[model samples]
Target: MQFENSREFARQLDKEDKLSKYRNEFILPKVNGKDVIYFVGNSLGLQPKTAQRYVDEIMKDWAELAVEGHFYAEKSWWDYHERFSEKLARVVGANPAEVTVMNTLTVNLHLLMVSFYRPSGKRYKIICEEKAFPSDQYMISSQVRFHGYDPKDAIVEIKKRDGENNFRTEDVLAKIEEVGEECALVLIGGVNYYTGQVFDMATITKAGHDAGAFVGWDLAHAAGNIELKLSEWNVDFAAWCSYKYMNSGPGNASGCFINKKYHNKKDIPRFEGWWGHNKERRFLMEPEFQPEPTADAWQISNAPILAMAPYLASLEMFDEVGMPALIEKRNKIVAYLEYVLHEIDKDVESSFEIITPADQDKRGTQLSVFLHGEGKELFRYLMDQGVITDWREPNVIRLAPAPFYCSFEDMYEFGQILKEGILNKQKV
Candidate 1:
C-alpha cells in the first residue's frame, strides 16, 4: 500500500476504512477547542462515549436497590464481572472459564506469581527481560526477596545485544536453555513497553515449558492492541490492564487468564478470597476453603462493579467488531503511520530512528521514535502543536494511532506537524 503525503490521500483511506465509524464511539480530547490528534493510546486510551451511561446504570442500581443490587439489579452486581468473561475471552483467545475480570494488572501479577512462580531447591531463578515496566521489575525483585533469594543472583534479565533496540527471539530461547535446569519461571511483557516489540509468545511459551519452567506474560500493551492466543499458546497465565488500548477508564479493573489446565488443580497455591471459593457454598461460610473450578478461583475479592462498568462497555464494542476486523484496520493504519514518519524524515532531513520493529507481525499499534538531533525540544513542540503523544526518557517519543478512534487524516496531519517541528528547529 503506497502512501502519499496529502490530506486527500488520508481522507480517501479513511473513506475506505470499515472501522471509521468507531471514532464516533469515543469522546476525543480537545486542544484549543478542537479535537487533538491523539496518538497516545499506548499510554491511555480515549474514553468511550458510552462510558457515562454504563457508570450511571451502576449508580442508579445502587441508588434504587441498595444492598439488594447484589441480586436484584438489572445486571446484578453479584456477578457483574461475569458479563465480561465471554467477550474478553474472545479478545484474549481463551476459554470462557479460563478468563476472568479481576484486580489491577500488577496485583494480579503478584497473585499469579504466588501460584506459578513457586521455586524449590536449586531451581529458584526467574528469567525476565531487562528494563521491564518499573512495577514488574519491583515485583520480581520483591517476590525474589520474599522467597529469601537475592535478586541479583535469582533473577536473570535478558537484555538486547549492544547497539540493538530489541531482543532476538533466538537469543531469548537460548537464554532459557542456558538456565533450563535452574530457572523456575519465565515472565515477560507480550509487547515491550519501550521498543514496542511483540515477542513470539507461542514459541517462547514452548521453550519455557521444555526448559521446565512456568511462563507468563504481562499483556498490558498487547491486549486490545494486538491479537493474542493465551490458551492456545499454552501460557501458564497472563494479565492486562483495561485502560490502555482497551479504552476502559483510568485505574480500571483488569482481566486475567489462567490456562484451563490449571482450573481444576486445587494443589496450586494462591492467595484466595471468598469470591474465589465454591459459589454454591459461598454464603454458607464454610471454615475450609473450597476453590472454584475456574480461573475465578485466583480472584481474591468480590467484583469491583463500579470500576468494571466502563470495561464492560468497551468489551461490548470489541465483541461487535471482533479482533480480526480490528487487527485488519490496525495493520493498515499503523503502516500508514510508518509511511508518514518516513516521509517526514525524508522531507525534513530529520535525524531520528524508529526503534519499533519494522515487521507488522512483530509489533502492535505503537511506534517508538528515537529523536537524534533535538529530541526533547521536538517532542515539546509537537505537544504544543496538539499532537498528543508521549515522551520516554533519553529521547523516544511513542505514538500509537489506535484503530478504534484515530484516523488516517490524523496520521497525515501528524506527519506534517512533525516535519514542521523539525524544520523549525533548523531555523533556530
Candidate 2:
C-alpha cells in the first residue's frame, strides 16, 4: 500500500475505512473548540460513549436494591466478574474457564508470582527484559527480595544489543538456555512499553518451558492491540490492565489468564479470599476453603462492579468488531502513520527516527519516535497544537494510532503538526 503525504490521501483512506464508524463511538478530548488528534491509546484510551450508560445501570441497581443488589440487580453483583470471561478469553485467546477479571495488573502479577515463581536450591533466577516498565521492575525486584534472594543474583535481564532499540528473539532464547536449571520464571511484557517492540511470546514460552521454568507475560500494551494465543502458546499465566488498549476507564479492573492445567490444582499456592470459594458453597461460608475450579480461584476479593462497568462497555465494542477486523484496520493505519513520519523526516530534514521495529509483525499500533534534538520542546509544541501524544524521558515521543477511534485524518494531522513543531524549532 503506497501512502501519500497529503491530507487528501488521508481523507480518502478514512472514507474507505470499514472501521471509520467506530471513531464516533468514543468521546474525544477538545482543544480550543476542536477535537484533538489523539495518538496516545498506549497510555490511556479515549472514553467510549456507552461507558456512562453502563455505569448508570450499575448505579441505578445500587440505588433501587441497596444491599439486595448482590442478588436482585439486573446484573448480579454477586457474580459480576463472571461477565468478562468469554470476551476476555477471546481477546487473549484462552479458554473461557482459563481467564478471569480481577485486581489491577501489578497486584495480579504479585499474586501469580506467589503461585508460579517458586524457587528452590539453585533454581531461583528470574529472566526478564531490561528496562521493563518501572512497576514491573519494582515488582520483580521486591518479589526476589521477599524470597530471601538478592535481586542481582535472582534477576537476569535480557538487554538489547548495542545500538539496537529492541532485543533479538534468538538472544532472548539463548539467555533462557544459559540460565537453564536456575531459571525459575521467564516474565516479559508482550509488547514493550518504550520501543513498541512485540516480543516473540511463543518462542520465549517454549524456551522457558524447555528450561523447566514457568513462562508469563505482562500484556498491558498487547492485550487489545495485537492478537495473542496465551493458551495455545502454552503460557503458564498472563495479566493485563483494561484501561489502555482495552479502552476501559482509568484504574479499571484487569484480566488474568491461567493455564487450564493449573485451574484444578489445589496444591498451588495463592492468596485467596471468599470470592474464589466454590460458588455453590460460597453462601455456606465454611472454615474449609474449597476453591473455584477455574481461573477465578486466583481471585482474592469480590468484584468491584463500578470499576468494571466501563470495561463491559468497551468489551461490547470489541465483541462487535472482533480482533481480526481490528487488526486488519490497525495494520493499515500504522503503515500510513509510518509513511507520514518518513515523509516528514524527508521534507523537514528532521532528526526524528522511529525506534519501533520496521517489520509490521514485530510491532503494534504504537510508533515510538526518537527525536535526535529538541525532543522535549517538539513534544510540548505538539501538545499545544492539539496533537495528543505521550513523551518519555530523554527524547522519545510515543504515538499510538488506535484503530477504534483514531482516523487516518488524525494521523495526517499529526504528521503536519509534527513537521511544524520541528521546523518551528529550527527557526528559533
Candidate 3:
C-alpha cells in the first residue's frame, strides 16, 4: 500500500477505517486547546471515557453499603477481580482458569518467581535480555540475592550483536542452550520497551524448557499490542501491567497467567493469604491455607477495587473489539507511521533512523527513531506542537500510535509538524 503525506490521503484512510469510531471512546488530552496526537500509549494510555463511570459505580456502592458492598454491589468488590479472568485470558491467549488479576507488574512477577524460581544447588542461574526494563532487572537480581546467590554469577544476559539494536532469535536460543543445566529460569520481556522489538516467545519458551528451565514473559508492551498464545506456547507463568496498550488507568492492577498443570499442586511453594485460599470457605477463618484450583492461587490479598475498576472498564472494550481487530489496525497504522517518518526524512536535513525491526512480525505499534543531527530542541518542538511522544536519552523519540485512538491523519499531520520543526531549527 502506497502511503501519501497529504491530509486528504490521511482523512480518506480514516474515512475507510472500520475502527475509526472507537476513537470517540477515549478522553484525549489537549495541548494549546486541541487534541494532541497521542503517541505515548506505549508508556501511558489515554483514559477511556467510561472509566469514570466504572469508578463512580464502585464509589457509590461503598458509600451506600459499607462493608456489605463486598458481597451486595452489582459487581461485588469481593469478586471484582474475577470479572477480568475470562476477558484478559482472551487478550493473553490462555484459558480462563489459567489467568487472574492481581498486584502490580513487578510485584506479580516477584510473587510468581517465589514459586517458579526455585534454585537448586547446581541449577541456580537465570537468563534474561540485556537492558531489560529497570524494574525487571531489579526484580531478577533481588530474587537471586534472596536465594543466597550472587547476581553476577547467577544471571546471564543475552546481548545484541555489535552494531545491532535488536536481538536475534538464533542468538537467544543459543544462549539458552549454552547455559543448559545451569539455567533455572528464562525470563524476558515479550516486547522490548526501548527498541519496540517483539521477541520470539514461543520458540524461546520451547528452547528454555528443553534446556531444563522454566520460561516466563513480562508482557508489559506485548499484552494488548500484539498476538500472544501463552497457554499454547506452554509458558510456565507471565504477568503484565494494564496501563500501556491495555488502556487501563496509570499504574492499575496487573493480570497474570499460571499454567493449569501447576494450579492445584499442594506442594507448589507460594506465599499464601486468605484471598488465595478456597473462596468457598474463605470467611470460615480456617487456620490452614487451602489454595484455589486456578491462577488465583497466586493472589495474596483481596482485590483493590478502586484501582481495578478502570481496568475492568477497559477490558470490556477489548472484549467487544477483540485482539484480532486491534492487531489488524495496529499493523496498518504502524506501517503507515513508518512510511511517514521516512517520507519526512527525505524532505528534511536531519536523518531519521528507526531502530525497530522492519519486519512486522518482530515489531508492534512503537517506532523508536534515532534522530541524527537533531537535539532535544526537536523533541521540545514536537511536544510544544501537540505531539505527545516519549523522548529517551540522546536524540531518540518513541512514537507509539495506539490503534485504538490514533488515526492516519495523526500520522500525516505529525510528519508535517516534524518537517516544520526541522526546517525552523535549520533557519536558526
Best by lDDT: 3
Which should have the higher lDDT, number 1 or number 3? 3
Name the regions of candidate 3 deviating beyond 4 angstroms. Answer: none
Please give the lDDT score for candidate 3.
0.94
For model 2 the local lDDT of residue 92 reads 94
Span of ten consecutive residues with least summed lDDT in model 2: 371-380
Summed over model 3, clashes come to: 0
TM-score of 2: 0.99
What are the per-residue Cα lDDT tens digits for candidate 3 across 102-144? 8899999999999999999799999999999999999999999
| Cα distance off (Å), candidate 1, residue 36 | 0.8
Better of 2 and 3 by lDDT: 3
Q: What ranking emerges by lDDT with the best candidate at the front?
A: 3, 2, 1
Residue-by-residue lDDT tens digits, candidate 1, 1-428: 77898999999999999999999999998887889999889888999999999999989989999999999999998788888889999999999999999999999999999999999999999999999999999999999999999999999999899999999999999999999889999999999999899999999999999999999999999999899998899999999999999999898888999999988777789888999998889999998888899898987789999899999899899999999999999999989998888888787766769999999899999899888776688888888888999999898899999999999999999989888888877987
Error of 2 at 164 (Å): 0.8
Candidate 1's TM-score reads: 0.99
Model 3: what TM-score?
Answer: 0.99
Off by over 4 Å in 1: none
